[model samples]
Target: MTATLIVIGHGMVGHRLVDALRELDRDRRWRVVVLGEEREPAYDRVRLSAYLGGRSRAELSLVAPEFAADPRIDVRSGTPAVHVDRRARTVRTADGDVLRYDALVLATGSRPFVPPVPGRELGNCFVQRTLEDADALRAAVRPGRPAVVVGGGLLGLEAAQGLQLLGMQPHLVEAAPHLMPAQLDVEAAHILQHGADRLGLHLHCGTTVTAVHAGPHGAARSVTLSDGTVLDTDLVVFAAGVRPRDDLPVAPALRLGDRGGYLTDVLCRTSDAHVWAVGECAAVLGRCHGLVAPGYRMAQSVARQLTGRPSEPLDAMDTSTELKLLGVHVATFGRTPGEDGSAIEMTFREGVSRYAKVFLRRDTGALLGGILAGETGSRADLAARVGRPPATDLERVLFPDPSF
Candidate 1:
């Protein structure tokens, strides 16, 4: 007799869980049911900005035709699971359908965090999270107009670049003193800022949006910064951050993390063993990782466990990241120097175009973390060598000789 596995949400991580289960469940022991809130199938949200560059919706899709056509898998797009009945082992959808499940997985993911400011509900305001959001932004884009993007993190920078690509002048506003404060140090962020300036992106760091002023037709016309500077703009985008979507109606509510996600164990299992949580919605051991890699790992671990295999513990999840933002290369891996005051820090710069920094343990020379800006050719190599001492001289490792 086959058991039923119901998965709520169909974002990248949820899709990954189903894909992994299909590969591991050789015995055909589980019938899979995936409920996606969005009408469109799973798509590559990381490159969602590419939609503004004329990339078709089909191009961003992550759903494989084979997986979609699998006989054992039932995908219900646009169907949102609203309630969970743990006692009855069932899930109730928003459309009045109740699904019975031998096991359940919550991959509801997250929602973009919009700062609570006056006039935020005005038209022409957006959050860069879904394909629909991209479509809305694309429709609102007017060539040569000004756009304000709140936040200077990865998503905010991406939004600004997309606006720029659409021929709109983009002004980035960051609450932090520097861009990507969570990942890059001040020097590295400065290097990235220089690159953004070269690309014609106006940045206003160390300030927050105090209020959004409305124009005619109730659309966002301008934003006032905390520093008393006001900039007129046609649109406003809030890319500050994300909060876990863990507001499911459960009869016996599951434990929640202090930071607001479903608290799960190392195995991605919630307080109810039959119900598991993965991706941004799951705060494994009271901490939530906002990166896709960690979510993928969690999905993989849960898939293994469901397939009767031992699951890998997520105690030391890797948080390495590398990306090109507005034509600037940036990468960070492991614990940054600021994350640990005891760590030894070393930095190097090359002619204002490149900067690199590495943090090592004070007792041992083992790598703790590193940051690279302007040049990131060594990102993969350096990330792979984390937790171990450099094989060569630290200088050569961080700043490889150009002659070589």
Candidate 2:
């Protein structure tokens, strides 16, 4: 008899798990059921900003037509799994349907975090997370009007650029002292800010949004900053951060990590042996990965275990990142500088548009971590070189010839 595997939450990672199972389950050992809360099918959320750039909903879809037509796979869009009966090994949906499963997986992903400031519930305030959120932002776009984007991380910067593409004057508000404080060092952030300035993007760093004041019609008219300054705006887009969606009702409450998310063992199994968790919702080894690559790896790990294959743990997952924000290329990889100041740090810069920094261990000269701003021609090569010594001369690694 074929067993049933019920997957809750149909985001990118959930879809990936189903796809992996389909490829590995050659004997058709298990039937799969996917529950998606959103009405729309799985789409490329990483390229969600492309929606503002004139990409249609169909263009960003990640679901293959053949996968949808698979008889063994059943995908229920717009259906949210409300509760889990661990003892009975069943799932309850919002539509009053109960699903029995031999094994269960939670891939609920996360929800965008909006700070608890006054007037945050105003009419024009939004969060950039799902395709629906993107559609809402696009519908509210008014060219030539001022818009405020909170947070200076990757998502915040991307939202600012998207607003600019929609012909809106975007003012980025970051509580951090500089942009991308978590990823880039001060010098690298300076170079990135210079590039953003050249693009006519307004940045308000070292401050927070105290409150948002409403207009006569009750929409967001202006915002008060922590520095006692108020700026007029048309809308507010909060791309601050995200929290795992781990509040699903379960008979025996699942273990959670210190920060947040379902605490999973090395094999991505939750407290329950029959249950598994993946993606942003699974804090494997008590740590949650926000990047897509790590999430994809976790999904694959779960699928491998279900198919009776050798499953690999996510202990060595790479956390490196590279992206272009406000037309400036930036990348960061490997371990950052240690707090004790043991790692040797080297930096190079030419003009305001370029900067690079690399950290190396004093004893072995092995690469520890590095940051790049402006020209990221060596991102791929340098990221691969992480944890190992440079293949060529140190100077060449830091400052490659532009002619090449």
- Give the deviation of candidate 2 from the true structure as CA RMSD: 1.3
State TM-scores per candidate: 0.98, 0.97
**Cα-based lDDT for every prediction:** 0.91, 0.90
Residue 12 error, candidate 2, Å? 0.9
Where is model 2 more than 4 Å wrong at Cα? none
Reference-based TM-score, model 1: 0.98
What is the per-residue lDDT of model 2 for residues 1-404, given as tens digits with 9 covering 90 to 100?
A: 79999999888999999999999999999999999999988888898888987899899898999999999999999999999999999999999999999999999999999999899999999999988899899999999999999999888999999999999999999999999888888889998899889989999999999999999999999999999989999999999989998999999899999999999998899999999999999998899888888889998999999999999777777777888887888888887775577899888888786888888888999988788888645777777787898666765765677788
Query: Total backbone clashes of model 2?
Result: 0
**Candidate 2, lDDT over the whole model:** 0.90
State in Å the error of residue 25, model 1: 0.5
Q: Give the lowest summed-lDDT range of ten residues in model 2.
A: 390-399
lDDT of 1 by residue, 1-404 (tens): 89999999999999999999999999999999999999998988998889876899999999999998899999999999989999999999989999899999999999999999898999999999999999999999998999999999999999999999889999999999999998888999999999898999999999999999998788999999999999999999999999999998987999999998999989898999899999999999999989999999999999999999998799888888989987888998887756546988888898667898888899988988888998644887887787899657766667676677
